[model samples]
Target: VQESEIGTAPDKTSTAFIPKQNEQNVLNDILSSLHLTPMDVYAADNTCAAGSKLTERHTFFPPFLNSSVARTKTLVHISELSKLHSAKRVVSDETFQDLCDSIESTGIYLYTPIYDSVNPRMPLPLRYECRQFPRASGYVEDPATGIAAAALACSLRKHNQRYFETNNDIVPHHEHTNSYDRFEFYQGTAMGRPSKITIRFVENKDQHCDDTTAVKRTTTRMLCSGLV
Candidate 1:
């Protein structure tokens, strides 16, 4: 994952672009191909309901494929990762092939972020499932995907903007430093080669003089770490 991390220098942190997908038909097509109803895909932090149209689209380039198209990573809040694992086994090969052909992404990445405990202050951990369609290359289910992890991090920030702003008490902060959030993605478990990707990001920071609040500028820095 993330270009094998070995014998490679990490790239600089870059801005994450958050786009909107207003095409209802596109979302429907993707869900139809996987034999998954809209209920299978929901937003993180319970920001959106099942079967609702989510306009935010999170995309990123696969570090291994610089010349390839951007991959779209989606958050699937279907209660548990076991449900997705079962669905993946039942989907037809033809359906997956058609999905890859119809979509710009080379694969479909779905993940669920669940809180390990009932405490609200605890961090959320993610369980990822990635299916590389046969049409793009071969029908392979990757054990781990760094691209999806990065995209999901950005998506979570965007979807939880309100919660982050209003719930400042729960936001992790430090003296003489900007407040930030951390996310851990657990992947490859279904295939037995489990891995964990950790992402830490710093959000907007503003400064003011003479008791006047300055203009708000968003600064997002994403740092990723993982085990093979």
Candidate 2:
């Protein structure tokens, strides 16, 4: 399942899959212990993988904390946050800002740019996923994403506000104004999003897409003017 379209790909055998033992149990344990599923802790335990030993040396894991944390929100499938579901879940700037903060902690990004801006009837979706692996690792594709640039924009604003107690927040609306036919995200500081990307079925590889090119691609730039 790791290599399939639906799978979280990890070529190396040592990589952590779902947490060991009862994957659901750890989620329940941490969530129940704090009476809240703070995104950072949840993500930490998630990447920790139940069986994987907690190591301070490792890049992903950390030592025990002194106090419990709480988040006043429910975790939803990332798919639920799409434009298609915006009418129902329209997250406010505050929530979106938190999302950006939570995202930076994980170092993953999921960005969907609105394609076909001129025609409302012909809205096209762009899937920006492709990377030329990283140093110390051979060419490989990451399984999860967190749409870095936008998320960072959101996080930077919030973190700045929280840290300095600034009244002037980072304006989410400012991210717009550019014709973003391409997306540069977390796969790497070196990661590159081509003009168009294609995912073929069965085979695990990129098929330079044609349909994407034909469509007038435009991205959805959400401005965090205020709460939802």
Candidate 3:
């Protein structure tokens, strides 16, 4: 009879797989096959300079916060947000690299928010999972970002208004609808660090309905727990 060793090896350990330059294209192709839609990009200026306080400590802000702590920072917008079953997901390496390049080229921050659409038990419409790239700091990802979240909320509000206006029927029926939009977001799982963020958009009743530009200016509040 042959004796068999059933126990596991004591020193067995797992190793991380690092991709090589030659295989990058193949890896990018595989990632691209995972059903990601190309996003529309836009540019905006950071309305607040609070990020200056953050940069004072050698910390970095999203590209939207601009490279410096100036009054207005350039912000890059990647709209047409997508939804995923889980917050933990991946995008094409090429897409990610392009985003990084855009940040370098535009000198702004990039924000992408993916959500879970099927979970009905959750009170919110969807669970927001956001990823932010800060190329200026030489970091590929930030665990969490309030500025990005706020920027996203602002973008969504503008999109919503445009959607209603284009429908024709909805606008005439509900002019100046004072509705509050709430969003709950999660981030940092991509880096093994988890964070939760909450965002709220409250439209000011005094907002000028006559001017489309005025409608773009709305109030947004963001709450989060973690280092942005």
Best by TM-score: 1
Assess the local accuracy of residue 91 in candidate 2 as a C-alpha lDDT between 0 and 100: 34
Which residues of candidate 3, in runs, are more than 4 Å off? 1-125, 168-180, 204-228
Question: In lDDT terms, how accurate is model 3?
Answer: 0.37
Winner on lDDT between 2 and 3 is 3
Candidate 1 regions exceeding 4 Å error are 1-29, 32-35, 43-70, 89-95, 101-103, 118-135, 166-169, 172-180, 202-219
C-alpha root-mean-square deviation, each candidate: 11.7, 21.1, 19.4
lDDT of 3 by residue, 1-228 (tens): 011111111111211112244543533332243333221321122111223221121111121222222211234323334422222225544555554453232222334433233432221124445565443445545677666555555444444454444544232112222122555566675667877766655445455666356554554443333443
Q: By descending TM-score, how would the candidates be arranged?
A: 1, 3, 2
Compute the lDDT of residue 167 as modeled in candidate 2: 34
Over all chains combined, what TM-score does candidate 1 have? Answer: 0.56
Q: Which candidate do you rate higher for TM-score, 1 or 3?
A: 1
Question: How well does each candidate superpose onto the true structure, as a TM-score?
Answer: 0.56, 0.19, 0.40
Q: How much is the lDDT of residue 86 in candidate 3?
A: 21
Distance from true position, residue 160, model 3, in Å? 1.7
For model 2, how does the per-residue alpha-carbon lDDT over 1-228 read when each residue is reduced to its tens digit?
000011121222322223333333533333232222323222212332212321111212111111101111121112112321121213343443433243222211223223233532221122222221111112232322223233323332233334333333232121222212222222222233323222111213333448555434443333322110
**Which regions of candidate 2 fall more than 4 Å away from where they truly are?**
1-146, 166-228
